[model samples]
Target: MTLLPVDEALERILDGVKALPGEMVPIEEADGRVLAAPLSAMRTQPPFDASAMDGYAVRAADVETPRAVRLRVIGESAAGNRFHGAVGASEAVRIFTGAPVPEGADTILIQENADLLDDGSIEATSTVASGRHIRRAGLDFVEGDVVLEQGRRLGPAGVGLAAAAGHAMLSVTERPLVAIIATGDELVRPGEACGPDQIVASNGFAIGALAKSEGAQILDLGIVGDDSAEITAAVQRAAAAGAHVLVTLGGASVGARDLVRQALLDAGMSLDFWKIAMRPGKPLMFGRLEHRNSRNPDSTSRPDTTGTMRVLGLPGNPVSSLVCAHLFLRPLVARLGQRSHTPDLRAAVLASALRENDDRRDYIRASVASGPEGLIATPFSLQDSSMLTTLAAANALIVREPGAPAAEPGSRCRVLMLA
Candidate 1:
C-alpha cells in the first residue's frame, strides 16, 4: 500500500469529523463544556445609573455657590432603594454606593472630601468634578449583546460572564464516548504476567487517558488477542455501548496475525480508508458500522449520527499507538465536542543541528523548557518509532515537513506542544 502524506491524512480525518451531540448542562456542570448555542445578555449591566462611591450626589454647579449648603436632607437611598422625590435647587439627598442617582444629580463628592459644619450643613472644602464617580446604566454591557459565542468552552470566567448577562442556563455539547480497545496477543493486564510473550496492556490505558484529555468520556475495552473472533466481539461491545469512536491497536498492521482490519469489516462496518502516510501509523484504518433506525420518517435512511462511530485502527507498537492517539484520536474527540481541534504549535529556536527530513514528515520528540530567552526545544537523538521511553520524556514534538532542508542552530522552527 502506498503511504499517505501527513497533511493529506490529517485533512481526511479532520474533514470527516463534525460536531457531535449537544445537551443543556447546568452552570455548575458546564465548566470545560462547549457551548451549543450563542448566549446573549438578557439585561444590561448596572441596570440603573448609580453612585459609585459612598458620598453625596449633587450637580457640579452647586459646589461653587455654597460655603454651606443648608438644604434639607429629603431622603436616603441605598443599593435597593430609590429616592422618590428629586432634589430641589437648594436640597440634597444622602446616598450610598450602588444607589440609583436622583433625577437632578450629576456628580458625587466623597464624604471624606466634605465636612459638616456647626449648623448641620455640608462645608464645601473640595471642588467637585462633573460626572465624578457615577456608574451609567448599561455602561459595562448592553442588552441583546452576544456575550458568548457558540462553540466556546466555558471556564470560570465564562460562567461568571454568562451569569452577569442574566442567563440561568446554557446549552452545551454532550461529551463524546471514546471506547478504547488495546489488542495484542503478547499483551496482558497490568497485575498478571508470566510468559515472555506477554506484555501489559498499556495502549488502552494510554488511549483512554488521551481521550479523557480531549474531553471525551472513556470506556476501556481492555486487550483483544490475535484471534479474529475476539477482535470482532470487542468491536461489537464497543458499538453496542454507543461509543462515538472505537480505537483498536496491534491488529491494524499487515502482519500475518493482524485481524482488526478484517474483523471490523466482517462485523458489517463500511470502510472509509486505511493506511495513512504518517510515520509509525501508516497502517491506521477508519470506518463505521451500520445501525438501523426506525424512529425517523425515512425508515431506510441512515441518519448522519448513526454513521458517526469513528473506528480508528492504530499500529501495534506502543509508541506508534500513542502517537496515533495524539495526532488523530484527540483531535477526533475535540471535533466531537465542537472544540478547536487544531494542535497548539508554538514558536521555538532550534537548539541543535537538524538533518534534512526524508519523504515522510517527522514528528520529532523533544523536551521543552522556558527561560528568559523563550521556549527552548531539544530533540531526542533517537527517532525510532517503536520506542515508548523516548516519547515519555517528550513534552513537545518538532515538526519537520517532508523534503525540508537542513536547519542549523538558532533557526526558527514550529514545535507542537504536548503538555
Candidate 2:
C-alpha cells in the first residue's frame, strides 16, 4: 500500500469525531474540564447598586460644590446590610466598600476626602459627581447572560466566573478513557529483572502520560507477549472496559512477530488506514472496533447495542511511539474533550545547515531558543528513531516536509513546541 500523507492521515483519523456525552459536576470539581454547553449567569451580579469605596453615601447635590459641606451621620450601611432611611438634605450614611448604596444616595464621598468632627457629622472637602464610586446593578453580568461559551476549557478564571454567575455546578464533557496495551515478548516492566535480550517496557507509561495530560483517564493493561491469543484478549478487555480509545505499543510493523493487526482484525476491527509518509512513524495504524456486551443474553429484553472503539497501533521504538502520540493521540484526546485539535506551531530560524529530505516528512528533535531575529531551532546531531535521550532533551520538533531541498543556517522553518 502507498504511504498515506500526514494531512490525509489526520483528516481520516478525526473525521466525524466529536466530544463525548456531558455530565454535571460541582463547580469545585469543574476545573480543567471543558464546558459542554454555553453557561449563562444564574443571577445578576451586584443585584443592587453598591458602594465601591469606603466612605459616606450622600446625595450628589449635597457635595457637588468645592466648598466643604457638613452633614450629620444619620446611619451606616455595610455589605449585606442596607440603611432603610433615605439620605435627607445635610445628612449622610457611613458606607464601606461593597455595601449597598442606601436609598436616596446618588454618590459616595471617599473617607480620604471627608473630615470627621467631634459630633456625629462629616465635612466633604472635594466636589463629588453623581453615580461616582458606585457599582451599578448588573455591573458584571445580568441574569440569563451567557458568561462562558460552549467548548470552553474551564481554568481558574473560568471557574471563578462560573461561581460569580451563581453556578454551583456546571455541565462539562466527560473525560475520555483510554486503554493502553504493550505487546512484545522481549519486554518487561520497569524495576523488574530482565534477561540479556530483554528490555523494560516504557512506551505504555509515556503514552499513558500523554493521554492523561489531555484530560483522558488511563487504563494500562500491562505487557503481553507476541502471541496472538494474548493480543486478542487484551483487545477484548479494552472493549469490555468501554474505553474510547485503545493504544497499542509495538507489533504494528509488517514483521514476522508483528501480530497486533491480525489480532485486532480477528477481534472484529475494521482497519481505517496504516503506513503514513512520516519518518519514525510510517507504520502507524488506525482502526475501529464494534463492541458488543455479551453479559445480557436475553435477545428480546437486551438489544444488541454496539459502540465503536478507536484503535491506534504505534511502532515499538520508544521515540517513534512518543512522536506518533504527539501527532495523533493528543488530537484524538482533545477531540473527545471538546477542544479544538490544532498543533501549536511557531516559526523559527534554522541554527545549522540540513541536507535534502527523503519522501517521508521528518520531525527533527531540536532545542528552540529566542534570538534577536526570532526563535532559533537547533536540531540534534543524531536523528535516529531509537534515541530517547535526545528526544527528551529537545524542547521542540523542527518540521521538514517531503522532497525538500537542502537548507542553510538562518533559513525559515516551522517548529512544534512541546510542553
Candidate 3:
C-alpha cells in the first residue's frame, strides 16, 4: 500500500467532525470545559456606583478646594451595608472599599487626604475630583452582555468571570469518551507476573494521560490477546459504552500476529488509511465504526446509538504509540470537545550534523536550550523508536521533511515542542 502523508492522513481523520452535544454543569465543575452557548451577564457588575477605596463619601463640591472643610460623619457604609441617608452639604459617610456610594455623593475623599478632628467631624485636607474613586455601576459588565462567547475554554479567569456574572451553572460541551484497548498476546498488566517473552503494558496509560489532558474521558478496556474474536468483542463494548473514539494500542502492523486492523474491519469499521509516511509510526491506521442496534425486542439492554465512533490503531512500540497520540489523538479529542488545539512549533538552529532523510518524514527527539543567538535544538544520538528513555529525556522533536538534504550545524530548522 502507498504510504499516506502525515498531513493528508490527519485531514482525512478530521473531515466533517463536529463537537459533541452540550450539557449543563455547575460553575464549580466547568473549568477546562468549552462553553456551548454565549454566556451573558445576568446582572450588572457592582449593581451600583461603589467606593473603590477606604474613604469618606462626600460631594465633590464639598472638598473641591484645597482649603480644609469640616463635615459631620453621619453614618458608616461597609460592604453589604449601605448608608440610606444622602450626603447633604457638609455631610460625609465613612465608606470602606466596595461599599455603595451614598446618594448625592459624587466623589470619595480617601482617608489619607482627611484628618480626624477633635470633634465628631472629619476635615478634608485635599480636593478630590467628581467620580475620582467611584466604580460606576456595570463597570465590568452590564446585564445581557455576552461575557464569554461559545467555543471558549473555561480557564481560571473565565470561570471567575462566569461566577461574577451570576451564573451558578453553565452550558458546556460534553467531554468525548475515549476508550482504549491494548492488544497483544505477550502483554500483561503493570505489576502483574510476566513471562520471559512478555512485557507489561504501558501504552494505554500514556495514551490515556494524553487524552485526558485534551479534556477527554478515558475508559480503559484492559489487555486483549491477538485473538480476533476478543478484539472484535472489545470494539462492540466500546460502541455499547457510547465511546466517541476507540484507540487500539498494538497489533496494527502487517506481521503474522497483527490482527487489530482486520478485527476492526470485521466488526464493520470503514478504513480511511492504514499507513502513514512518518518515522516511528508508519503503521498507524484510522477508521470509523457505525454503531448498530442489536438489542432483543424485549430485552432490557440499551440499543446501540446512531453516532459513528472513530478508531485509531497505533503501533505497539512505546515511543511510537505516544508520538502518534501527540500528533493525531490530541487534535481529534480537542475537536470533539470544541476546544482549540495548536502544536507548539518553533524555529531553531541545529546544533549537530544530520544525515540525509529517507522518503518518510522524521521526528528526531532533541533537547532544546536558549542560546546567545536563538533556540538551539540538539538531536539525541539515538533515534530508535523503541527507546523510551530517549523520548522521555527529550523536550522537543526536530522536524525533517521527506527527501530533504543533509543538515549541518548552525542550519535553521523547525521543531515541535513536547515539553
Q: For all candidates, what are the clash counts?
A: 2, 0, 0
Residue 357: error of model 2 in Å?
0.4
Question: What tens-digit string does per-residue lDDT give for candidate 1 at 1-419?
Answer: 56677666667777767787667666877788889989999999889989999878877777765455554566787899888778666566778999999988888877787676576556556778878999999997899989999999888999999889987778998788787888777888888964876767777888888888778888788877789988888887777666778888778767788888888899888887888756656677887776532222212343434455778888887787888788888888888899977788999988898999777667888987885789888889987977888999999999888788999988878899988
TM-score of 1: 0.83
Better of 1 and 3 by lDDT: 3
Q: Please state every model's RMSD to the true fold in angstroms.
A: 4.4, 3.3, 2.9
Clashing pairs for model 2 are none
Off by over 4 Å in 3: 293-304
Q: Once superposed on the true structure, which residue ranges of model 1 sit more than 4 Å away at CA?
A: 64-74, 90-94, 116-121, 185-200, 292-305, 369-376, 384-392, 405-407
Task: Give lDDT tens digits, candidate 3, residues 1-419.
Answer: 67899999989989988998888889999988989999999999989999999999999898977545789999999999999889899999999999999999999999999888889798888989999899999999999999999999889999999999999999999888899999999999989999999998999999999999999889899999999999999998888777889999989988999999999999999999998999989999999998854532223554545788899999999998899999999999999999768999999999999999998989999999999999999999988888999999999999999998999999999999997
| lDDT values for all models | 0.79, 0.91, 0.92
Residue 127, model 2, lDDT: 85
Q: Cα deviation of 167 in candidate 1 (Å)?
A: 2.1
TM-score of 2: 0.93
lDDT of 2 by residue, 1-419 (tens): 67999989988888878799788889999988999999999999989999999999999999977545789999999998888889989899999999999889999999999999888688899988999999999999999999999999989999999999999989999888799999999999999999999999999999999998888888888999999999999999888767789999999888999999999999999999989999879999999998964422212343444578899999999999999999999999999999987798999999999999999999999999999989999999998988899999999999999998999999999999996
Model 3 alpha-carbon miss at residue 300, Å = 14
